[model samples]
Target chain A: MTDNMYIERSCRISENTIWLDGAPYWKGLPAASFIDFAKEAFRLLKVDYPKFYKMDNLSKLVFLAADFLLQQQDKDGIALVMANRSSSLDTDIKHQQSIQEKESFFPSPATFVYTLPNICEGELCIRHQLMTENIFLVDECFPTETIEMYAAYLLRSGKAKRVMCGWAELFQENYDAVLYLVGPNGEKEHTKKNIEDLFR
Target chain B: MVELKEELKGKIIEVLNLEDVTVGDIQDGDALFGDGLGLDSIDALELIVLLDKEYGIKLSDPKQGKAIFKSIETMAAYISENRTK
Candidate 1:
């Protein structure tokens, strides 16, 4: 790795809390439910993007983290590499419930659209008009080592100028996301240790 | 007519996820799509499902939705005329 390689920025969202760059960006938000908390966060951000209301809980958590982390920058060819434990399980349950009953079988298109975890990548790309390399990995835990290696490879190969990597896990009402922007120069090292430490 | 418009407004807000909007915010003549209420194509599909599920009014053609869903006034009129349930 080059000596100049580092993490440019980072953001985390969990429960009713939000943190940016290892500091509290927003706190004391409603802890009622993830849906309620996401709504409250969307309102607080004052963003006019109506599509946010259409996203599932997992996508909403990841989108909000990306919104806080990368909204200021004008970036292109950004690679998105994310991993999650739950892997869209919450949405899968909702989608199953929607089609389970024969008497009340109703498969909603909106809910079905979010069955895949990578839909968050599509949502983020849509929000920023970014058409770039993106992948979503479902693992038992935060796969920081895999992310670090992948991001470094993409950067070194010149496939990506920057990498937005993180862990966005959502199951039921519990959610945790830690997104880091990795580039040639920053304040934090773009290593597995630093990425895993940021999640805590 | 007034009651149907109010009901349509409530359903639109609920189904379309217009959390910040209220029935009072929507007027009878205001356009439901584009600039008036800022609804998109996905919302159009949800409204179609709402018609069949809630009122038993099935629309077979997508083009018919444009005229029927022009405004709350038109939607209430179409539902009142065609709803079987």
Candidate 2:
């Protein structure tokens, strides 16, 4: 049953750089804010999806990195398992600010929509048309073991032909995204330790 | 009418996140949903919010959206007659 299980590929996105398979994929400018840097990376990606601009910082980070990973890997029957630490706190704060001001109590529907971290997952599924089972977990740290088990369970139980798992966390300007696809065959082993090591 | 159409077009582009589209790209009579501009249900909701926020027009019923948002021509006419802002 484990014959085909392997980590097909991986991508990591930090504040100023993007890494794919442990190497520098794209490096952004130093002085620019993370949001601007993400926009630069999106422009570099040259993806035609116009909805990227409307997304919150978290979704944009995950969207940019997942765009690369999904392009490089098989997307069919792929379930998404995403985790984050802040869990949409940045957008929550922005949404709160929109309504909390008594002088201008106008609550923006646009900012209010992105108050959940799982909305990033929904954005990814919408962009790629991935109708597979998806879940978003939150913890103080990267729940490496939980993600590994969940992805592995889905693959082994035939719930999904493949699994895409990662951590995409964004708060204020600090952000990180590391997405990896697991399938029956690949260069990297789909073990818990290997997945954890990729982050280091 | 021409100025209002232009203003509506600009608002639609800004509100809907039609990044690739410009005011010049939209024709007054062109359909705003399905096939023409390809906006979905979420964009429709955003447009409803836009009508209220920018023009001070409140659409209490979702069904009213279909007629009001049919085209830039219709939207411009409605806004001209009803907009409080």
The candidate that achieves the highest lDDT relative to the unseen native structure? 2
Q: After aligning candidate 1 to the native by TM-score, how far in Å is the CA of A50 from where it should be?
A: 2.3
How does each model score on lDDT?
0.86, 0.87
Which digits, one per residue and each the tens of the lDDT, describe model 1 over residues A1-92?
35357999999998688998989988744646888788887888788887788888888999889988986786787889999988888999
Q: What TM-score, computed on C-alpha atoms, does each candidate reach?
A: 0.93, 0.90
Per-residue lDDT tens digits for candidate 2, residues A135-163, read 99999888888888889899888888888
**Regions more than 4 Å wrong, model 2:** A101-105
**How good is model 2 by TM-score?**
0.90
TM-score of 1: 0.93
Best by TM-score: 1
Please give, for every candidate in the order listed, the TM-score of chain B alone compared with the true chain B: 0.97, 0.95
